[model samples]
Target: MNTTPLVQGYEVVIGFETHAQLCTRSKIFSRASTAFGAAPNTQACAVDLALPGTLPVMNHQAVVCAIRLGLALGARIAPVSVFARKNYFYPDLPKGYQISQFELPVVQGGVVEFFLGNEKKSVRLVRAHLEEDAGKSLHEDFFGQSGIDLNRAGTPLLEIVTEPDMRSSEEAVAYARELHKIVTWIGICDGNMQEGSFRCDANVSVRQPGQALGTRREIKNLNSFKFMQQAIDYEIRWQIAQIEDGHPIRQATVLFDPDSGETRAMRTKEDAADYRYFPDPDLPPLYISDQMVQEQRALMVELPRSMAARFVAQYGLPEYDAATLTQSQAMAAYFEAVAGGCGQPKLASNWIMGEFSRRLNADGIGVAQAPVAPAQLAALIARICDATISNNAARQVFDALWADPAGEVDAIIDAKGLRQMNDSSALEQIIDAVLAANADHVAQLRAGKDKAFHALVGQVMKASKGQANPQQARDLLRVKLQ
Candidate 1:
């Protein structure tokens, strides 16, 4: 019932189909290595290539991964499930049919919630089913012909299907990111978009208010968030224009050309009936016992939402701060370590979410690879809290610490001479000098001009080489004036 419109009269309806490549050492059906970047045909074995008389065997580790994801999303883990043969012919599909779940998926009916600028949004998941990946068709590497690389064939994939709940590209991207975090956080997948470990297909459509849903075009293999947003926005605009021009939108598969910044038709999308799905005769029904589910539950870590709530209650942080800190497990751990070390949860949250995140983004690294350790950041925050360094001086110290991650904070503070002037009598001398010098401004303050007092504070800070404690300087100036 959300009516957030993308154009003047049309609302965008979007859903996602995300593929998270499992981290098992071997293929889902075969014993072939699933490691990426192997030479063509080097990793594909007889079982992967569907040689005659070679039957597929399921990987137990893959099931464990599915269970972990289902538990994390609070989804129903079906005690029994079956695999179906998705009939499709493609150059990369060596078997001309993919082994996937259709009628009965392993996980079903979950909800993923995340924040979009302080407004929390939830998307309902249709199912997360296990499947085998098709191989790759290499087009860019050949001069006059395309080649098939079966290295990814039979690789395990968990396809997470979402209901059409997202109304904008922003929501879709946020949903994708949250799902990626869950998979990675639970150690099911590496969440490497570049290596194709995680990817999303967006089903985008434009509909008139209260009308039947429009036909959707599926944008495939959006591996980057920036590209995902651009593709969805461009597709929405294009579909709206088509409708405005009295053209009907066709349901098809499309590819996002990052260079052109537009989506182009790839092929006519195949419906379930067209694929001729049927239960696979080669593999039996998959069954999970009560004990298996219990074991997985024990292995599960606290979800991001639960952890964020705890942060709000225990650390007294705002909901936004809690959510931001819990974006990743490593980030949450770093924040906790800093907060616990310094005993200033709010300040720790501010610095970690602000300066720490900014620098990490600039350096093109994750929280795990940050140069400033939690202990080091905690030391810097402690210095600020104790009035040993002003806010600006702390920033200087932080920059030095980032540059030389092994450098002691106190050593850097002394080397840069950025310590705040906290001695009351010594600060009194500077305030008295400024008061004697700025007689006109002092007269303006006596006449009830607050700006004059601010000007005096600025002069006091400047005279002290920008090392005066801001709050302390303001308080001493007030007392002297009285």
Candidate 2:
């Protein structure tokens, strides 16, 4: 009997559909408040609940936001579009249908480029459209009873759909994170996953090289990065194992069990045809003017990629350092503030990335909320550059400044007595004492023992209570020993 061998490490293809709730005050189609954390059904109105005799009205702010995002992604905006009712049955969806764009999406054909390690990867966006979010279902105690929360119902959502351009879970995650940054930086979405403001769904499949795509599984409602990675990995393995056992992979929606690190079938996947999409009779088609698109485009700030490149070219920083410093808008702004005034770019980068980041992490503070002011930090850097104090002494001053933002840097330096003893006479006495204390090492040094010289430097530092300039002490020791 002949048996087929199991395939190991088959390439996994991943695409993401991210839903970001727009930060708007009112619902997409109604006067209902779109605030989160309201009591059950408190924010719902006649239009949101889809009651009889209620008509859906489009929110102008929601449209503007969607167009802004589309322009930022370099997507083409549709001059006209229509809203279709997506037929679905779910407990959270108060209405039996969801109002979303089907064939006539608001924006189409864009690509987002981000770096994964050193290689640049691009995720092609198929479309980004406006939609109304559904209500929330709360399953507490779970003895077959659940409660529904309608506060989130009718919230405005921008659903971003991506092509299957990613080949691994890590690439998918990196793309998602970059997308999150863009939305947040543009002030479109809060990008808060825990609060359900930003949510992701991953479609995963495996195929041999140069073959048609296989049956894909949709992992739904992943709220965190770790779950996004784990869900895709487990789904890929499960699909591969089924294929190895001569079972065909099925098209379905699945739920991820984070505790068990596995995915279980939810239901059969439905295509657009199954949704019975059609233009809504109650709402009119949207018509956006070219002037509006141009306005939104003009409002876009320097994006992450362009800003990172400028940091490298303008500031003369390495690519890696610039990328790390510009990971967020706040960090980039902080770096710029410190790097201003013709300051040393490399030194500023090192301080911000090293001691500044260390202090922020240790104090449990964010860069935006850091207690240290930019001017104060810049002054400290200036002090180090001018040799007002040793690097070690400057660190002590930094701590003092961190403790009291209003404290003077020079006063702190003087109070801490951290000035380096650079005077030859003052350092000569400490050097003499070190030479007398380590006579054996001194003899070995005269006998051509180069290693003993380091011991003398250590002794000099110790005798001077770590205040002696190491370079000057070493130079004087070498001259005296000769």
Candidate 3:
């Protein structure tokens, strides 16, 4: 609910409609293969093409996907929901309409909670209805006319719609990412934006504070988060420019062109009336017994939020850290194993989120594919905890281990001569010699210039060649200065 204006004096209000393709083996109403990259129309069944003597039968797995989503979002699952034909004409739609839930949907009234930076954000759900996908019109392969790919036709999709709760483009992106994680975590959808497994439609508008909501234009089919933010920001500026110029904002659907970094009007935005939605005469009501809901719930994996909460309670991590670590199951598992092995959750968290993730992003890989194993990382952290190595030395060890993942932590440290000098007697001699040589530094410290103490410590570090434990050196140096 951060209503602060991102730019200009208008408060930007945005809502999202995301269609997450379900992880079903078959289409929503047809037995067509729900696979990607098939030859155009090869995977389409007779029902998918709306051929003669064909009648739509609901895919039971699609209903299960809807149920799983409802449970994950804490939404209400309707025991009885009706499917309707949404009349719309498109070259890709063979039936000239889409079968979707209208008056009643399977899932209702849920909230998606996430963090925009450290601030918590929650978007209220209007409804998440079960629907069938349309085919794709290919214009690249054909010159004069567009070709249709019915392979994607009748594919199962869960259209998750949100209330107008987001106030900024950043918040909208955060919400979309959180929704993506939830769907993928629950194993309901693959959550692939590039392949169109997950697609987002952003409804963006702006208004003066305490004024009636302004006319909103829908930005359709945003696949990239970076591009989504760019589009929303541009749209906000464009709409404000229109209003300030004394022009009315027309409601329309727009597409973001990544090449131009701009949004162009695709068509006038269609309202519910334009669709002419009605009950499908061919299909019966969708009934989900309470038992069905419980069954899906039983099979559902431990959700990201639940695991994050556990991280906070069990490992004494901050809410932010817990949420970040639990962004994926593999990262969470890696963290737990390292924390359990080293008995240092905070350090483990820092290494994983900081260095580990940096490397992962740099190498374009994931935690599961990371070269460093959990045991190896845990052993590295243990060295730091036991004063066997300094943080700098540990980082060096990590680098060596990254190069050769099978390399042991202690072996690398010993081989590279990265072990810290922790012996108090040896450090005391070095401290005494530095103190004697830098009597001017002592005089400066006596005069209350705190930096002179660090100069003295630097002399000791130089004398010890960075082998001295810095913290222990500071402690011993403090006593000698007193």
Top lDDT hit: 1
Q: Rate the local accuracy (lDDT) of all candidates.
A: 0.94, 0.87, 0.93
lDDT per residue (tens digit) for residues 1-482 in model 2 = 52212237466778889999998899999989987677789999988887888999999989988888887788999999999999988887877999999889998888888887877778999999999999888888858779887788899999999998888888889999889988887888989999998999999988765568888999999999999989888888898889888999889999999999999999999988999988889889999999998888888888887898999999999887887787789999999999893297788899999999999888898897787888888888887787667788888899898889888877887888877788999899888888888899999988999899998898898888778887889999988897
List pairs with backbone clashes in candidate 1: none
What are the runs in model 3 whose C-alpha is more than 4 Å off? 1-3, 141-145, 436-440
My TM-score estimates for the predictions, one after another, are 0.97, 0.91, 0.97
Model 1 residue 241 lDDT score = 95
Worst-scoring 10-residue span by lDDT in model 3: 1-10
User: Predictions ranked by TM-score, top down?
Assistant: 1, 3, 2
How does model 3 score by TM-score?
0.97
**Candidate 1 global TM-score:** 0.97
At residue 120, candidate 1 shows an lDDT of 89
* Order of quality (lDDT): 1, 3, 2
After aligning candidate 3 to the native by TM-score, how far in Å is the CA of 186 from where it should be? 0.3
